[model samples]
Target chain A: MFRLLIEKELREIIGSTKFAVSFGVCSILILLAFYLGAANYLASVAQYNAARAENLRQLEGLTDWLAVRDYRIFLPPRPLTTLVSGIANDVGRTIEINGRGDLVAHDSRYGDEPIYAIFRFLDLDFVFQIVLSLFAIVFAYDSINGEKERGTLRLTFANAVPKAHYILAKLIGSYAALAVPLLIPLALGSLLLVVMGIPLSSNEWMRLGVIIATGIAYVGVFLTLSILLSSLTQRSSTSFLMLLVIWVMSVIIVPRGAVLLAGRAVSVPTIEENNAKKGKLNAQLWREDREAMTKFQPSSSSDPQRMASEFQKLMQEMADKRDARMKQLSDRLNEERTNAQQVQRGLAFGIARVSPAATFALATTALAGTSLDLEYLFRDAALAYQQAYAGFMFKKTGVNLSRGMIIMRTESGDPEKPKSINANELPVFTYSERGVSEVMQAVLPDIGLLLLYNVLFFAGAFVAFLRYDLR
Target chain B: MESGQPVFEAIGLTKKYEDETLALDHVSFSVRAGEIFAMLGGNGAGKTTTINLFLNFIEPTEGEARINGIASHKDPLTAKRNVAFVSENVMLYPNFTALQNLDYFSRLGGKTQYSKENYHAVLRRVGLQEEAHTKRLRGFSKGMRQKCGIAIAILKDAPAILLDEPTSGLDPQAGFEFIELLRSLRDDGKSILMSTHDIFRAKEVADVVGIMNRGKLIMQKHAAELAGHDLEELYMKYIAGHIRDAA
Candidate 1:
């Protein structure tokens, strides 16, 4: 009996023109997102290689390591970022490591290319969040009430069909009918990835698989919610209107609204304010250092080279002292701001998770390693690389390269040509992505929330259907 | 299983909506095997409410509606297994062909053993043309859709059938053909309970006739007893609250 009901439902939906149109649109969007993501990733890779080569080209012909200036490290793009995108494009990718001061990332993709930021990339996350979820609503918003309006519900229930079996069959049949066809586009998209030579490691492949699974689960939440609303209302038109309002709230409003509300509740210092505080301390330290530099006296009967070396050592000491003081103030201010931001983030995401769409976005972004945390991860990695570069510079030049040092070359009439410094010896910067295990741990909660939404809505639909008035 | 055993029974079945409207009040009636009981009434006269109780579409406010000795509300799945229903509009799946709709409803009615030929034969039995059998019902007319509905009931082969205002929208020819189909089903020993406002059609085909008004079953009689009496006049008097005990 259950099988018969499910078969009828499948036939009823699959044979409709509505299904045909929705399926066609979804397939095209999914394939387009895959194609565009692959193309975008390729473009980013080419740009990154060119920029790195230019950085190296500029470093050629330098006679001393201390003269190396404007040496920049770039955050490499990952293949998954082209699909999920989260905050990857908004955060700065380039960090100029001066080897002494705070390493601030610069040259964000969106900052450089404002047009792309105007309408963001059409990625897999957008396709699933905006398009597929709406398709789910389109397919299921009239599942129950439409039958009643058509007078089929009474006729169907006139037999021995149990309400439980009928509702369950409706959910399973609709999901199967819609979700199974979606896999074709997804499989083709994955094949596109392989053909386009976007090399995804095994860990990345698993994350992608989970991301697709979460997308399907997100679709299920809308499907079951539509069915629930249909069962609760009397007329199909009324149910459809209610479902549209709910879709708007869940997809468009809730996530952003929660963030705005959290913003009002939590107060964090602005970047300019923190920068002003650090600048005040730096000015005070510079005044004191200058007074000390003015009091320096040369040694009696000193050789010219010896006097120059003594002056250099004194300057290095004063510079190191000022740097240590600035670092102390900067770390304190950054930590205070970071603590407040974390609080705001926790509260905002907690409330935003009420919508399954938000949960799905969170889970997929975490899997892709392009989440909001990407900003912190990139900066931290660059800071760690700065220490390595600073240590290497000290070994070669006998002074920190980032200490505002001025090298003077007073050449005699017949000075031999100095050998050029090797640019290849500079420490390479590699941005390490989060491990699969750690990403899975971060995504697990959101995945659970999505599943919970599915189960709760299905249960609501089931209960509503059981008490539904077929007459 | 006896010839006169009741296949559908309503013992003091009553229904009251949440808005305090008494839809059905202390209504009691039975449809025996091989019997055609036509319930005659106007709008809001509780005719459809009784049928709803029998189908277990809604729970009774007071008493039991039984089908084949099973109380519908207490054990709806078991009670509904023995009954078939045809609504006023007979709206089957519009996207399905007549044969496809018949095949589906037949299986839902627990008659999965029927073959495709059986579905074609039943569609023919209900006067649906062979060409229309495979065509989608989306463009079907009222009469064609009605024929498909009756075909599903026939294919179900349940001992009891409930038809709620089944002939309300049919034209003269379609109405006459429908009456003939009902009589044939009766001849096959299927107990049928139909609710309608057609007095003459009820007089012509019904073995037993019932008239209800404002949630009360005011008049009931065998066709033999109503042979010389004017059913229309009686239905009017009963509906007007003039006669109370005309059974």
Candidate 2:
């Protein structure tokens, strides 16, 4: 009996022209997003290789390892980032690994290419949040009420069918009709990535699988919500209007409003204030160091080698002191700001998670390793790489670069015959992605919330339909 | 089951809408097996309300609408299994073929063993053209749709059928064919409860004709008793509130 009812539902939706048009539009958009994502990743790969080559070319004649300054490391592109984007485009991609002071990342994709940010990437998350959700609403907003309007409700209920079985069939059959077909485009897009020769690791495949699963769950949220609203209203038009208002509030208004509210509610120190304070402290330290340097007298001036060693030692001590003081101040300020921002971000996302769309976006982005956490993850990886770099430079120059020293070796040799530095000897930065288990653990809350929503709305629809006036 | 027992009954059935308007005021009637009970009234005369109660689409304010000795409200699913219903509009899923609609409603009525041939035979039995059976119902005419509804009831083979103005929009010739079909169904021992405003058709087809005023059954007569009487005049007199004066 349930099978027959579900079959009827499938036949009803599949035969409608609405399904044809919506499925077509969704397919085209999904394929386009995948194609563009591959193209964007390829472009980034080219740019990364070019930047590395340029950094190496600039060091072709420098024999001294300490002479090479501004050796930059770029954040490598991940294929999944192109699909779920998150804050990947918003955050900086280039971090200059210096032997001295605190570092900052620069060269954001959106800064370089403002047009893409204006419309944003047509990623899977956006499609699921905006397009697929609309399709769900369009298909299901009148699911129950439309039957009433057409006068089929009374005719159907006249049978021996239990309202529970009928409502469950409606949800299952509609979901199968709407969501199963969507997988076709998702599969095609995934194949397009392979066809474009974008290598996906086994881990990446798992992440992609979860992303698609979450997309389906997200679409389910809207489908059940529509059914709930449909049973609540007498007219399809009224249900649709109410659903449209809900969609707007959940998808567009709530997440951003929470962020704005959090921003006003929580106080974090501005970057400019931190920078200005650091600048003043730096000037004071430099003035003191300069005064001390003026009184520097090599006690062993009669011995040329001793005099050179003594002078290097004194300079290193002063530089180390200044570095320590800067570190102390910067660490304090950063810790303060980080604590405040953490509170602000926690409040914002907590509120935003009230909406399923926000939950989906946040979870998928985290799974894709491209949420706002992308910025900190990249910085942490670069900072770890700097440790190996500092060790390598110390071996090459018999002096730790972390001393923030300027070593001047005046060599009287032919400029054309100067030996080149080995760029390969520089420590390579390899970023480690969050383990699948770790990511799954992190987003379990959101996924659970999504399922809870489905159950709640399904129950709501079921209860509402049981009492619904078939007439 | 006793041979003389009523297959469908309304015992003191009453319904009041949320607006406090009484839609069915302790209306009582019964259709034994093989009886054609035609209920006649003007608009909002508790005719369709009676059928709705029997189908359990809405709850009755008082008493019971029983099918095959089971109270519809007490256990609607089990009770409805013993009955079939065709609403006024005969609206099925538009995307479904006539045959598909028959197959669905037949299955819903718990007749799962009906085959394609059985559905086609039933459709043909209701005078639907063989060519129209497999075509979608979206483009079907009102009469064609009505034939499909009757076909569904025929396939259900239930002991009782509740039709709410089943022939409301059917043409004269279609109405005549539907009446003949109803007569044949009655001969097959199916109790039929039909609500309509057509007085002459009620007089012609029904074994027992009931006239309702507002929410009360004001008059009832067996076809044998009503023979040679002008049913249209009687219906008009009752609708005009003259029955009380005459009484």
Candidate 3:
């Protein structure tokens, strides 16, 4: 009997024109997302390689390590990032490793191409978050009430069917009818990923698989909610309107509203304020250092080279002291701001996760390595690389490279020209993505929330239908 | 299923709505095997309410509506297993064919053993054309949809059938064919309870006739007892408060 009810529901849905149109639209959007993601990834790789090569080219003729300025390291693009695209494009991609002060990433994709920011790329996350959710509503908003309106509800209940079996069958059948067919497009999209030569490692493939699963779970939330509303209302139109409003609230309004609310609730110090404080301290330190430099006297009976070496040593010591004080103040301010931002992020995401759509986005972005953590991860990696680069510079030139040291040379005194340093000899900076286990740990809570939404809405629908008036 | 065995029984069934409308009040009637009982009444006369109680679509405030000796409200699944229902407007799945609708409903009715040939035979029995059997029901006319609904009931093969104003929207020829179909089902020993406002059709086909007014079953008699007496006039007398509690 349960099987028969499900079969009827599947036939009813598949045989309708609404299913055909929704399936077609979903397929096109899915394929388009995959294609565009692949193309976008290829473009980013090319640009990244060019930028790295250009940075190296600029250092080709440098005769000393101290003169090598404007050296930059770039954040490598991941294949999944192009598809999910959470904060991947929003955060800066290039970091100039100066071995001094703080490492600041610059040249973000969105900043470079503001037009893309205005209208973002068509990624899989967008399709699943917005389009598939709407399609879920379109498929199931009339699941129960429409049958009543068509007079089939009375005819169905006139039999020996249990309400539990009937409602369960409706949910399972509608989900199967709508979600199963979607796999065709998804499989084809994955095939497109392969055909386009986007190199996804095994861990990335697993993440992508989880992302698709989460997307389906998210779609289930809307589908079950639609059925719940249908069972609660008498008219199909009323159910549809109610579902539409909910979709708007969950998908459009809730996440943004939560962020705005969090913004108003929590106060994080802005970057400009931190920078200004650092600047004020730097100015006072520089004035005192200049006075100290002016008061320096040369050693008696000194060789010209020894006098120059003595002055260079004093300058390096003062600069080192100044750099240390600035570092201490900067670290303090950054820590305070980071803590506040963490609090604000926790609050925003906690409230936003009330909606399944936000939960889905959070989970997929975490899996794709494109969440807000991407910025922190990049900066941390760059800071670690800065340490290595500074050590290398110290070895090449017997001075602290991060102390703002100035090198002076008299051209006429040299009998032989100095050899240009090899730019390739510099230590390479590599950024590694978070391991699969770590990402899954971060993503599990959101995935659990999505599943909870599905179960709760399905339960609501089941309970509502059990008490529904067939007449 | 012996002859004269009560397949459908309503013993002192009472229904008082939350609004206190008194939809059915102590309505008691029985439909025996191989019998056709017609409840003749106007709108809001508690004719449909009794059928609803028999189907357990609504619970009776007091008393029982029994199908094959099973109280419908107490054990609806078991009671409903022995009964088939045809609504006044037999709306079916518009996206399904006439045969498809029949197949689905029959399966739901626990008659999964029927084959395609059985479905075709039942559709033909209900007077649906062979060509329309495979066509989607969306474009079906009122008569065609009615034929499909009756086919579903026939395919269920339950001993008892309930019809709520089944012939209210049928044309003259369709109504006559429906009457013929009801008689054939009766000959097959299926107890049928139909509610309608059609006095002449009730006179022609019903073995027993009942008239209800304002939640009360005012008049009931065998067709033989109603012979040579105007059923319309009798119905009018019961509805106008002239005849009181002649059940």
Candidate 4:
């Protein structure tokens, strides 16, 4: 009976030209995203490879006595990256491995560029949260109310079937229809990833499976909501209107509203404040050290050779003190950013999590390794590598290293005049894809929210339906 | 089942809308098995409400309504399965052909494997032309829709059938032909309760006739008991003289 009902529902959905048109639009959007992502991925790969080749060529030109140390890192994109495109490819370096604070520096790069990243990505996250959710509303919004309009509900209930079975069958049937269009496109997209040479390990496959399950759960949430709304509204058109309002609130209004509220509650200091604070702390350290040296100089003996030796020792000590102060200032600035970021992420998640759409989006991104968390990891790694390279330059050559000028020569390279550094020495930025057990832990809250929504709506519908004036 | 047990029964059935407009009030009536019962009344007579109660489409505010010995509301599915109904407008799926509509409805009633041959037989019984069965209801006339509706009732083979103004839009000759068909259904032992304004049609075919006013069964008598009396005159007498007294 359930199978038959599912078939009927699928036929009804597919039979409508509206479903066909919307499906076509969705397919086109997905295809476009896939092409665009693939193009960007290819472009980035080419850029990094070219950079590597330049470094290699420079190494080849150097003399044997001169060792070329490289500090470039390379992290390959996983096969499922195309589906969720999580912060994996966008936030971290392709390759970087110089002897530096790998963990601390990786935190600063936080993915490559937010602008180029998905503000509204077209992966499973987008499909489940935005597209499938809409489809669910369309499918289930009119489930009972439409029958009432057509005078079919009375006719249907006039048979020998329990009302609960009837309503359950309707939900199950509509959900199946909703899932097919989403699953097909996603499966095809994953296959495309394989074709593009992204390796999918067993664990990644498990993560993908969870992503699909989450999608279904999210759809169930929307389906139940629509059913409940339909039961409450007398007219089909009114029900549809109410559902539209809910969708807009959940998908658009909630996330943005939360951001607005968070912004108002706590004003994050501007980048200028961050830089200025850093400057002030560094200056304070230098001032104290200068005073200490001045006192030392005044008391020193006037013997020519002894005075020269003391002057050299004092200069070296001053440099070390300057480095330590700079480190303290940088640490303070980073800590401030981390605190602000934590508050912002907390507010965003708290507000957006109310919406099933946003819940699905966050879950899918986490599964795909393209979330803000991964982006932050990449930034931290890059920052640490930079600091290590700066320290090396300061100690070995006495050259003050700027952020961009720090480079290394790889081993087995020429000895002299190698302008470009070896790519091999760069630290490779790798994204640690969360395992199934870990993903389940990460997404439990979202799952709970979605399930809570489902239960709430279904319960409302059941209560309302039991007392409904069937006439 | 027994002589005293009615095939359809309602006792003090009452309903009021949420805003408290009394649509049906303290209404009660019953029909015996295999009998043709006609409910005759003027506009706003609560005839439709009474029919709805029997079908369990709406719950009665007080008292009880039953079909074939089962309380309609308590066991609506079983009660409704034993009954068929044709409303005045006969709204159907306009997107489906008449045959498809019939097949769809039959399946809803738990009848599958409804071949075209079986549908044509029922359609023929309802006096519908074979060619009209393939046409969508979008182009159907009131009379045509009513015919298709009767065909559905016949296909269900329900123990009792209810028709709301079955001859309202038909020509006099067509109306006569339709009632004649109802007479044959009666012979086939299907109890029928029809609400109609056609007193002459009732005089011609009904075994028992009832006059309702303001949700009360004002008068009920066997057609044979009023055999010599003019039905139209008796109907006018009740319409003009009995409503206030019945209330």
Judging by DockQ against the true structure, name the best candidate: 1
Write down the DockQ of candidate 2: 0.70
TM-score of the second chain, each candidate in turn, equals 0.96, 0.96, 0.96, 0.93
Q: Model 1: which residue pairs collide?
A: none
Candidate 2's error at B48, in angstroms? Answer: 1.8
Docking class of 4: acceptable
Model 2 regions more than 4 Å off: A286-321, A408-418, B17-20, B242-247
Q: Rate the local accuracy (lDDT) of all candidates.
A: 0.91, 0.90, 0.92, 0.73
Which digits, one per residue and each the tens of the lDDT, describe model 4 over residues A9-87?
6666665666787678766666665555565566656765776677566556444312445645444444456567755
lDDT of 2 by residue, A287-318 (tens): 99889888889887789999878877887888
DockQ order of candidates, top first: 1, 3, 2, 4
* Alpha-carbon shift of residue A423 in model 4 (angstroms): 5.3
By the DockQ metric, which is better: model 3 or model 4? Answer: 3
Best by lDDT: 3
**Prediction 3 TM-score vs. true:** 0.95
Q: Which of candidates 2 and 3 is the stronger one according to lDDT?
A: 3
For model 2, residues B1-247, the per-residue Cα lDDT tens digits are 5887999999999999899999999988899999999999888889988988998888999999999999999999889888988888887888889988888888888788988999988888889988999999999999999999889888889999988898888899999999999999999999999998888788889999999978899888999998878989878877676456636
lDDT of 4 by residue, B1-247 (tens): 6754678787888888789878777877788777889999988787888888888878888978888888887988889888887777676666567887788778767778778899988888887888998987778887888788888878777888888788898887668778888988888888889999889898889999998876767789998898899998988898888755656
Give per-residue CA lDDT, model 1, range B77-174, as digits (tens). Answer: 99988998999998899999999999999889998799899999999999998999999999999999999999999998999999988898899999
TM-score of chain A of 2: 0.93
